[model samples]
Target: MQRTAAPRQIAESLTELWSPRIIGELDDSYVKVAKVHGTLGWHSHDNEDELFFILKGQLRLEMAAETVTLSEGEMFVVPKGVQHNPVAEAECLILLIERKTTLHTGNVVTEHTRSLAEQLRSV
Candidate 1:
């Protein structure tokens, strides 16, 4: 058996820009924290939905139909296979709930997706 405390610290002690920390994981799902700036590329998860919860600052979610702005304490879910991009005008903190096998950016294979494997960890 394993035990961990609530409110885990996910960001690395020295990382800057797009650092994701694993706060908690259970069964087939996990929670992650990320410090984000700039724009993430358009992508989608083929087999899973992604839930994004804004923790601090603001974020803009762009889809083919419309762009939605989420503030602190707000949240949005991107359905499976629905292309979307997340952008932040400034540094923002967000919590992501997703499946353990879900890729950060689907099959795009861009620089952003390259580090996804390293970003995930057991909490």
Candidate 2:
């Protein structure tokens, strides 16, 4: 059977902070939704790029070079090997598109890092 979902609806349904739940799969990547607040810390995916799409609210992506602010209906792609930290002032809903092998947190792992197994669980 093929699973169908509403990314925005599911994104809003999430209650955990920084914990991303897999909503679907595409080719070699996974589509995930997360409800975030505060910062996720600095990390870099050495080999894969990550896409951040705001479903609701806003986000600020901080990197060594610069910071990018994204509002609702906006998106950004953090290229491979760039260290970034995502921060949300209030509760925000976001959709992430990343390679299946991408770590929850790139090189740096903190208390908020979610393992692949954890993300793969049913939403």
Candidate 3:
């Protein structure tokens, strides 16, 4: 079915924290939305770059070298193999663009790590 997805709507539908739900797909990539708070563990995707677009609240990206802050309407791309952690002091909504093969937590498996099967489920 052809339809339009609202990131905020998708995000609001999420019941789990830090869990991403697939909203759409584009070629080899999947478009996901998540409602996140607190911190996500540091990890790196060996072969896929991750794109993060903030749809609400604030986000802080902590990398090995520096930290980047993103507010609503901002976006950032973490290059492949770059280790980084994401933190949100308050509730934040984000849209993620990642390859279909990209792991939820990259090389590190944390309690928050989600399987592709989990992400693909209806929100």
Q: What TM-score, over all chains together, does every model reach? A: 0.84, 0.95, 0.97
Question: Lowest-scoring 10 consecutive residues by lDDT in candidate 1?
Answer: 5-14
lDDT of 2 by residue, 59-87 (tens): 99999999999999999999999999999
Preferred candidate (lDDT higher): 1 or 3: 3
Number of backbone collisions per candidate: 0, 0, 0
For candidate 1, give the lDDT.
0.78
lDDT of each: 0.78, 0.93, 0.94
The 10 consecutive residues of candidate 3 with the worst lDDT sum are 1-10
Q: What is the C-alpha RMSD of each candidate to the true structure, in Å?
A: 2.7, 1.1, 0.9
Over 1-123, each residue of candidate 3 has an lDDT whose tens digit, in order, gives 668668898898788999999989999999999999999989999999999999999999999988999999999999999999999999999999999999999979999999999998888
Judge candidate 1 at residue 18 and give its lDDT.
61
Better of 2 and 3 by lDDT: 3
Clashing pairs in 1: none
